[model samples]
Target: MTTLLPPASTTPAPGGGACAAAATPAAAATRRPVVGSVHSWDLSTGVDGPGTRFVTFLSGCPLTCLYCHNPDTWRMRDGKRTTAADVVAEAGKYTRFIAAAGGGATVSGGEPLLQPVFTGELLHRFKHELGLHTALDTSGFLGVRATDALLRDTDLVLLDIKSWDRATYRKVTGRPLDPTLDFARRLADLDKEVHVRFVLVPGLTDAPDNIAGVAAFAATLGNVSRVDVLPFHKLGEAKWQALGRTFALHDTPCPTPEQVTSAKGVFETHGLYAV
Candidate 1:
């Protein structure tokens, strides 16, 4: 979730002339415009979306979450500059398989909304052209960037709400909490389908009040169809080490299954289906 932009490097032409510049910009404009900075792509099941999925992990994020597993995705320049057409072409390969299994495409991130135009175009292609269900996995930090056109094509949104309290949210992710809240409200107003994901860390986000607060807020939003109370783990510790960053929860224990169940109970108490 850390938003870090590494300096970009430009490769000069061998002849070192204006002709090189012309070839680059003109060709780029003619193509999909290189809007989606891609980190990676993969196939997932029973997780990102309804059934199976082709997940696109884009680059760049606004919030620096302490538990971010893919710290390498923080820098936009580090990702491959890809176009929507190429993305759809790749997804099209498994279109029949995904459709048969009641699955579709999911654009996850660093923050897919960081490149709204690219994400929008990709989703549009999947929904309109390929006849596929489209989902966006986001932190809701850049929710304002989700234009109506984009939302129109997205069938589901996997919004990761880090924390409920503003102070605690800021502490967990080096960003304000309001933007995510505002985005959630927007999704509700649009009546968009949403699956809320909340991680339960033993010492950080496991406070009873914090869990209750998130549950209360989610209950207010009628669009929320499900709550995923995930247990914290050290899965991302290696990534942090590789990045030469401090892994804050190194010694913190993960939430016990009982604790996870209790957190889910809070959401159920609010009459929302939670797991």
Candidate 2:
């Protein structure tokens, strides 16, 4: 299961930008234009990225995935307004802890690219000020927003490739798949380190052709270091219900171990590392 820690309290920074001081009151009222809508954060190990991570959950997503656990993050307005300085201040508190564990900061979503400026600034500070590695967890729906300048600061990308077929992609996530494919190609061109994620839903995304398509695509990207085939689960049913939304996969079974192994086999067959 993904470990979720309590939300980190934020304080305003002395200033804005990548060189801002890491001291500010936690109760500051003003919101910077480059600020992000933050939902929550967690300190996790062996999941989000390499080593332990101080994962910041920035709110505002463009895609509406069927199995999104944190449905509360769907909207752009329902989150704490925080500047890059505030995030850096909060993450600074654990600098030593994170470094000791060989982990860094991961800017996850709702989609981090939705708030490109804030995400970029936060990434810059995390790497320059704190001397930490940076990773971005995104579906690439808004990948166009990830400018070359912003991507220059990012060390790795946890790219989620939902499906291979365009129709099935639209069904799983209320968005097209070509943009993600384009983003993947761009990242490959830039030689960015990427860990590709694909969730294996039993009835929706477990088709042999879909798996092969994704794996074949990944194999073509020399920058893709690993492929993570995640199993679908009903862990977010309650969240959907609490939000007064229909949970479409109530009867959808989780992929069995054999199914997961088979999916992994697809990636392996393409000469890509899978887990």
**lDDT winner among the candidates?**
2
lDDT of 2 by residue, 1-275 (tens): 23233244443345555434231222121243346678878887865898889888988898989988888888877877766676787789999999999999999988999987778887877887898999999998888988786788899999999999999999989999999999999999999999999999988999999999999999999999999999998888898999999999899999899999999999999999999
Could you give candidate 1's per-residue lDDT for residues 135-170 as a string of tens digits?
999989888888787898899999998888788899
Where does candidate 2 have its weakest 10-residue lDDT segment? 21-30
What would the TM-scores of all predictions be?
A: 0.88, 0.88
**Residue ranges of candidate 2 with Cα displaced over 4 Å:** 1-33
lDDT of 1 at 267: 93
| Positional deviation of residue 71's Cα in model 2 after best superposition, in angstroms | 1.0
